[model samples]
Target chain A: MDLTLKIWRQASSKVKGQFVNYQVQNISAEASFLEMLDILNESLVAKGEEPVAFDHDCREGICGACSLYINGRPHGPDRGITTCQMHMRNFKHGETIIIEPWRAKPFPVIKDLMVDRSSFDEIIQAGGFVSVRTGGIPDANSIPIPRRNAELAMDAAACIGCGACVAACKNASAMLFVSAKVSQFALLPQGRIEAQERVQRMVAKMDELGFGNCTNTYACEAECPKEISVSNIARMNREFLSAKLISHKEF
Target chain B: MGKSLTYSSITKKIIMSLAGLFLISFLLVHLGINLLILFDNTYESFNTAAHFMATNPLIQTFQWVLFIGFIIHIIYGIIVQLQNWSARPVRYMKKGYSELSFFSKFMIHTGVVVFIFLIIHFANFFIVAKFGHVDEVTYKSGTYENLGAVVVETFKIGWYVAFYVVALLLLGFHLEHGIQSAFQSLGINHWRYTPVIKRIGTLLSILITLGFIAIPLVIYFS
Candidate 1:
C-alpha cells in the first residue's frame, strides 16, 4: 500500500508545530501503524532529514506509551486498540493519514507526535495508591472481596494510563482517566481504607494541573483503547462527594 | 481539606446537575400550569392558576429559588464551557469522526438558544404580569392579572408561535441530554438503572416539548 502521511513536525516543546506531508510507497498492509512510521523514518534518515518523533514502548500495546492521534482519533481509525496495534490495512491504498500528538494543556508536545504526559504522573503521585505497610504478600482469601467488586476493580484497573480520554474529550477533561484510577481501588476492600483521601487529592491535583472538567460527553469512553467505561466517572463523583461531605478531611 | 468544593471540577458539575434537575422539575410544573389554558376558551382555570402562582407566598418564594437555579445553571455552564475551550489551545486540522452522542455535543449551543428564548418569554409574560400593567379578569374566587390572555394573544401571532415552537424543540434537545447527564453527574449511574434513566430522560423531554407546543398551536388555531 502507498500512503500519504501528514505528520505534525516540531523541533522542541517551545516551538510551533505544523503538519508536514510525506509519502511512503510499497508498504505492507499488515505493518503496524508505528512500523509504518518507522519505514518513513528510515527513508528520512537515509536522506539526511530529521525523522518524525513519537512516543512508544511495549509495542504490544499494554505499556500505554504510544500516543498518536491518527485521522482525528486517539489511536488512528481503529477502535479499542493502541496506535501500535493498529495495522495499515485499516486504511485505503492511497489514504492521506493525518497524525498528530495528544493536544492538551497538561500533555505538551515535546516534538513531532510526542507529548510529555508527566502530568499523569503528578496526578497519580497526588494519591493513586494505598499506603499499606510492607509485609509478606497476604493470602488473597483474607480480604473476602465479592466477585462482582473484584471484576469491577479489574475493569477499572485496565486503564493503561493513555491520554486518549483527554485527547478525545472536547474539553480535554481527564475525568475518565482519574475516575478509572479512583475506581480501581474504591471498589475493593483494601483500597477502601484510603479511598476518601485518594479521591480528593487526585481530583484536586487533576484540577490544579489545568485539565478541563467532564461534561458527560462520553467521548473518552468511545476513544478509550482499553474500553474503559464512563461508569467509573460516576463512581468517582460519588466517592468525591462523599469524601468532601461525610469525611472530615482537611485540604 | 482547605480546597473549596466549588473549585473542584466534579463539584462544579454537581452544582450544574442539581440546578439543572431543579429547572427540569420546574418545567414539568410549568407545563402543567400552562396546560390549563387549553381546557376552555374562557381561560378562567388558567387565569386563576396564574393568579394563585403570582400571589401565593410559598409559590413566590419558590419562584425566587427557580430564578436562582437558572442563574447558577447558566453562569456555571458558561464558566465550565470557557475553561473547556481553553483546555485545548491547539486545534486539530481534521475533525473527529467518532460516533459521539450528537445532543451531548451541542448542549451549550442549545442552552444559549433556550436562554435567549427565556428573555423573550419573560418579556411576553413575566414582566407584564409582575411589573407592567396587564388586563385583569374576574373569577368566582377573585380577580387577578389575566396572564392566560397574554399567552393566548402571544401565541396568536404566526411568527411568535413559530419562534416558540422552535425554541421549545431546542429546549427539548437540551433536556434530552441534560436530564441523563444531570443524573450521571449526580452519581446516579448504574448498570441496572442508567439505561432506564436515559430512556426516561428522552421521553420526558419529548413530552414536555410536545406538551408546551400544544398550547401555542391550540391557541393559534382556536
Candidate 2:
C-alpha cells in the first residue's frame, strides 16, 4: 500500500522543527508501523538523504522504547499496544499519517521521534524502590501474600515508564506513572516499610521535574499502551495524603 | 513546598474539590428553598424562609463562608487552568484527543459563563435583598420586604428567566464533572465507590439544576 507521511524533523534539541512530507510506495500491509518507518528510512538512506531517526528497541513492545505520536495518538489508533505492535493494515492505502514526538516539557525531543525520557528514570530513582538489602533472592513462599494483593501489585508493576501517559494528557501529567510506582510499592509487604518516605519523595521529585498535574481527564488511561488504570492515581493520592497526615518528617 | 497550598499540586486539587463540594452542597440547600415557589399558597413561607436565612446568626456566618468558598474555588480554578495552559505551550497540530469529554476541554469557558451568570444573579437578588431598595408588601398576612416578590419580579422578565434557566443548565454541566472529580481528587475514590459516586453526582447535579430552573419557570409562567 502506498502512503504519505508527514513527519516532524529537527536537527537537534536547540533547533526548530517542521513537518516534512515523504511518500513510500507499495509497502506491505503486514509491516509493523516501525517497520514501515524502517522501510522509509532505507529509501531515504539510499537516496543520500539523512535517515529519519527514531527510538525503537526489542520491537516487541516490552521495552517501551518506540515512542511516536501517530495521527495524534500516543501509540497510533490501536489500543493496548505500542507503536511497534501496530500493523499497517490498520491504515487504508494512500492514507496520510502525521507522526510527531511526545510533546511533554519534561520529555524533551532528543531527535526525530526519540525523546529524553530520563526524567522518568529520575522520578523512579527518587522513590520507586525497596531500600532494604535482602541478602539473597530467597523463598517467595515464605511471605504469605494474598492473591488479591499479589494481583494488584503486579497490575501496578505493569508500567513500562513509557511517556505516553504524559503525551496523551492535555496537561502532560505523569500521575499515572508516579501512581503506578507508588501503588506497586504501597501494596506490597516488602516495600511498605518505607511507604511514608517513598510516597513523599517521589511526589516532591515529580513536582520538581516540571511534569504537569493530573486533572482526571482519564486520557492517560485511555491512551496507555499497557492499559494501566487511573485508579492507581487515586491510590497514590490516598498514599500521599495518608503519609503527609501521619508523618512529621519533611522532604 | 514552602508550606503553601499552591506549591503542591495535590493540595491545590484537594482545596479545589473541598470548595467545590461546599458549593455543591450549598446548591442543594438553595434549590430546596427556591422549590417553595412551586406551591400555590407558600409565598409567605418562601419569604419567611428567606427572611429566616437572612436574619439567622448561623446562616449569616455561613453566608460569609460561602462567599469565601466561591472566591477560593474561582481563584484556584484560574490558577490551575493557567498552569495547565503553560505546561503545554505548544498545542497539538491535529485534533485527535476526543477521548475525554468537551467538559474537560471547556471547563474554563463554562466557568467564565457561570461567573458572568453569577454576577448578574447576585446583582439581581443578593444586592437587592441586602442593601438595595426593596418595597415592603403586605400579602394578607404581614408586611415584610417580600423577598419572594423580589424573586418573582426578577423572573417576570422573559429573557432574564431564559438566561437564568440556561445558566443553571451550565451549572449542572459543571457539577456533573465536578462532583465525582472532587471526590476523586480528595483521595476518596475507589473501584467500588467511584462508579456509584459518579452516578450519584450526575443525578444530584441534574436534580439541583432542575429544582432551581423549576422556580424560574413557575414564577415566569404565573
The DockQ of each candidate is 0.81, 0.62
lDDT of the structure predicted as candidate 1: 0.91
Query: Candidate 2 residues B144-179, lDDT tens each?
Result: 677877888788999999999888888888888888
In model 2 chain B, the worst 10-residue window by lDDT is B1-10
Question: Candidate 2's fnat?
Answer: 0.48
lDDT by residue for model 1 (B30-79), tens: 99999998886778888888878888999999999999999989988988
Task: Tell the DockQ for candidate 2.
Answer: 0.62
Can you give the lDDT of residue B35 in candidate 2?
A: 79
The positional error of residue A206 in candidate 2, measured at the CA in angstroms, is: 1.3
The digit string of per-residue lDDT tens for model 2 on A11-115 reads 889998889999999989999999999999999999999899999998888998888999999999999999999999999999999999998788888877788
Fraction of the true interface contacts (Cα pairs closer than 8 Å across chains) found in each model: 0.80, 0.48
After the best TM-score superposition of candidate 2, give how far the Cα of residue A242 lies from its true spot, in angstroms.
0.6
- List per-model TM-scores for chain B: 0.95, 0.92
